[model samples]
Target: MSVHILIIDDEMNWIKTFSDILIDYQVCDAEDIFNATNLSDACEVLRNNAIDILFLDLNLGCESGQDAIQGLRAEFPNSTLVVMSGVTTGSIPLMCMERGAYDYLPKAMSTDELVLSIQKVISRVEHFDRVRFAPNDLSMVNTQLPFSSYVTQDEKLHSVFEYLKVVSMTQHPILITGESGVGKGVLAKAIAEYSRPNGPFVSLNVAGLDEQMFSDTLFGHTKGAYTNASSQRTGMIAKANGGTLFLDEIGDLSLSQQIKLLYFTQSGEYQRIGSDLIETSDAKIVFATNQNLIELIELGKFRKDLFYRLNTHHINIPPLRQRIGDIPLLIKKFVHQAAEDYAINVPHISDGLIELLKSYCYPGNVRELSSIVYNAVLKSDGQVLTFSDFEFPEIRDIESCSLNAEPETNDTSFKRLDDLFDEKIIDALRVSDGNQSKAASLLGVSQSTISRRLKKLQI
Candidate 1:
């Protein structure tokens, strides 16, 4: 079905221009377009029609657009409202976002930029719809945690999901460890959604935050807390009251900040900066880090006490390279998503392309793979995506080496060496469930050797 877009702007010329742009870009059918010059008309259209997207001009001729944002949001909660204004001061956009606007775009944008903004909002709306109305199949259920958007067919991820379910119900602080771009934040959100569905999920990246910033951001400052502090600010913990406070990149917290966080974790109380009164928050803490906390603890970079408190429930997400079978599934999802975002036909993924992707060790994990697919789709001219479409440097290097390298002098010895090491490595990896360390131990080889062979053999 074509998406219905309602454009509310007092300027008839601007409305015509935006309408023409959307029509030319094929954002929606011409018949699906609706326009209103004022708040009353916009409300009437919203009440009568199921508008998929609403573009509201922040400055109506005589009406204050901000006044209508909350009302419209309350009336049409499903419609994705995008606020547009000529004001470039940035505060208006932030205010609009705080008032539940899906996005804010400068009214001076080119047609392409405007279309891109609309497309982004549409994609988000569609994603939320899919998540809300996902299949009720028993097989799709995690069976441990409540249903979430994090889908996986891999057994390792399924085990993680199960563990997340058990940990979600507890108030204990959780530590989720994984490589960067392995969806640590996504898992944290899933945990929050499962445990405190109705409460706010407040996230703060503690990396690069100094002691003062850390304390102020987490345990917000009261009025007159500092020279620049003119008003009171609620900290993440208080904002996440009765919900989950997700502290990402916790490994970067300094020793002093760690001590403060540990105190809060143990006592569930904190005082705002420059405040005499102490406040308490019932926010569940969830911490995630790509860094090795144990190593940091040993190095005296991370406090042992804080580590113990955070690891009351620990989960390690396996890297994408270890779950090769999920590569095709993730590619398929990303391809369809990219197609929808670009307003183009979904490109087909060939088996050769899938095999090529599966062979490479994705150091950046699932996020890197998604980027590869999206970039390929952007460059694709045909329906089918082949191996050449992917721009992975590692794969190209391995191929170049194989084709250009000189032949071995002892062909028989080379053949024997390849068969012996390759077969044993493959067998060991199978037994170890794609764990390189375990595979190396089983084969009595160093982990580095296993890694080198896996790359050399293009496995």
Candidate 2:
């Protein structure tokens, strides 16, 4: 994408060199006051130039670059401003970025670094575009505590959260399936809160555990079981008795451990590592995995019986790309939380910036979002985060549809059938207060259809 960049510096030599380095992009320069007699004239130049980006020097003669940034931001809200300065670090760049500079660069930067920064800015803008315009249906059930400061506008995520509230009320084992960083742990914790607010909520990542350790850690030993067993020890399952037990990456459990887990799940009973006697714990089990268990079962990596047992009540999280609409909401939520955590003011988001985030595929999902916002907040140093804080991946390798184009297929075609589908379903569900059968009947659809559609669309 060729972006029109406006250079608002007074140095003729540096401006010429800067424009030369930006040969891959379109650069417009205002080298001296003669080019723009006054602030109004400068604003007029920016207004008429149809500029996408601004490279403003810190010293703009008697007029400071700070004033120009503020003026241009007010005049051209869509333009992404870049603050370039010979002076390193301090309040000026912060003020510039806070006022709405897309990025800040040292005037002495190498041609390569300068070009890279510009490309990064362009990539972010593109990513945001891909996510902002997609449609979704978002709902808020009773917000649970430890109330996931993790933000996502993704309708699918909201629905998962809503379903999590209801599923949390039961002791049925929950199988959470998703790609890594889709907030499975958050969902598990939310379920734990729902099960027993005051009871113990213990979580174990079963990924690295061996057979003996897995059994021992889950079911406590009664003194003298092993060489290290100097005294009786309570395991996580026992510790979580009457509460929730979360097993993360349960797909990583060995076959033997899977059998042991299945036995306990089936009968609510387990045996410690060296004990013959059976012990029972009434803890609710919630397991999460990024793996496809069906494939795992077919490959003989995961046990079929265990998969079925854990999947009694399942929650599959959609990835970031599927829920593009959630990008801005998540970004806004993250910015606010980051500002609060860092004791800084919340930053403003540019429309182009929003479009940039939506365009990229967040392979790391919501966790990536948190990291990006946190880093951006640190870089901003109390200023608003610009496209500069966000580092985009190489765009040449990404698929076009995942970047700039609208999704060719709306797999959730049921949503497109009619707007009434949403209104009727939501209205019935609300009036019935989450009675599936009643809601289905009210909508004149079979209960099975309602269940099937909800499972398919994950709403």
Candidate 3:
């Protein structure tokens, strides 16, 4: 794809030569090549042109290129950041990465190296552009939603969807992991829908089950096998024949339970309780966990063999706080759905309310967001929903407390901390002309930290 590229260097000759080569290669037109001499000039250029790639020289007179990485990243999040330097030795590249440079390039690059760098940057940016969420009336305008159950506008999640789509071609057992409430179960079902659309999708949460209960639930028990076994009962594996069997909370399984599961996952063979005859199901196995299985393995609580058997393909859902972009779409979808389900007139939502809600870090992820939205809908007594309609434990406690004490004194410290951090974030944003990266630089924090604080403060 033809792209706009900006080159920043103190040497005007280098910029001219580079622009000429890129234009000759048909990578971009003359009008698309923007050149700047330093970080200040580069920022000014960015304000006028949203380039697809930025080639920033490490040495710009007296300025180091590393100084621009974070600010540029914060301002033009979608632009590819490449740091070119004469000195790329020691931990310079690593330092650039920490500051958010996408790639590092040596100044003395051959034509082949230049071409390869351009190709690499182009390829990376193209993937991001393809999967990036475009705003629409409701959700985002993409190829299609991952599934009806998912309400998101996160590029990271979209990348995850792309990966799942590719892996669906194989029948390997899939492992899904995430923090609780990030919707591992929902992701598991989406994987099932994608991979085994024609077959059933069954799920079981095996967190608290014992050996007998686990075995009975997974493998059907024969009649008269136990005191309560008065009739034949089919197991989840049998019920999910020819489809996907999702085992949630796999990390909670005991070592012995892991053995049984490992055997079933390794070979489809299993036997009914009190019956010697072996039975097999054609179900595709899927496992999910919020816990760190690797950590559990280190502690000897989980079987390494079982973990290997289940981790043929892995998907980890990021937490809600990391993908705040989804907040608007999620709010819209949940508001309408809740109104429809409860048979209430839909309340008009405002950008203010959305902004307020977006600031909250949903520890419960999508499920928590849904609950908050549903509760607000139910509590509203007017056409428009407001902050009063929503009840947050942190907010309420924060409203009731004074910030004179330590945070550990009570849950009220959450709001206390917010009150303190929010002031600094807002001040920085104001001083920096509302650029999150500049604000972060002013406050000596990461850009994401500034962004999150602003969101938390609903600024």
- Stretches of candidate 2 exceeding 4 Å from the true structure: 1-139, 142-150, 392-396, 400-459
Task: Give the per-residue lDDT of model 2 (tens digit) for 71-188.
Answer: 7777786666777889875455545554656667898888778778877666544443333333422254423344354355565566566556555666678888888887888877
All models: lDDT?
A: 0.77, 0.69, 0.76
lDDT of 1 at 36: 97
Least accurate 10 contiguous residues by lDDT in model 2 = 28-37
lDDT of 3 by residue, 224-252 (tens): 99998999889999999989899999899
* Predicted structure with the largest TM-score when compared to the true one: 3
Model 2's alpha-carbon lDDT is 0.69
**Per-prediction tally of clashes:** 0, 15, 1
What RMSD value applies to candidate 2?
25.5
Cα TM-score per model:
0.56, 0.55, 0.59
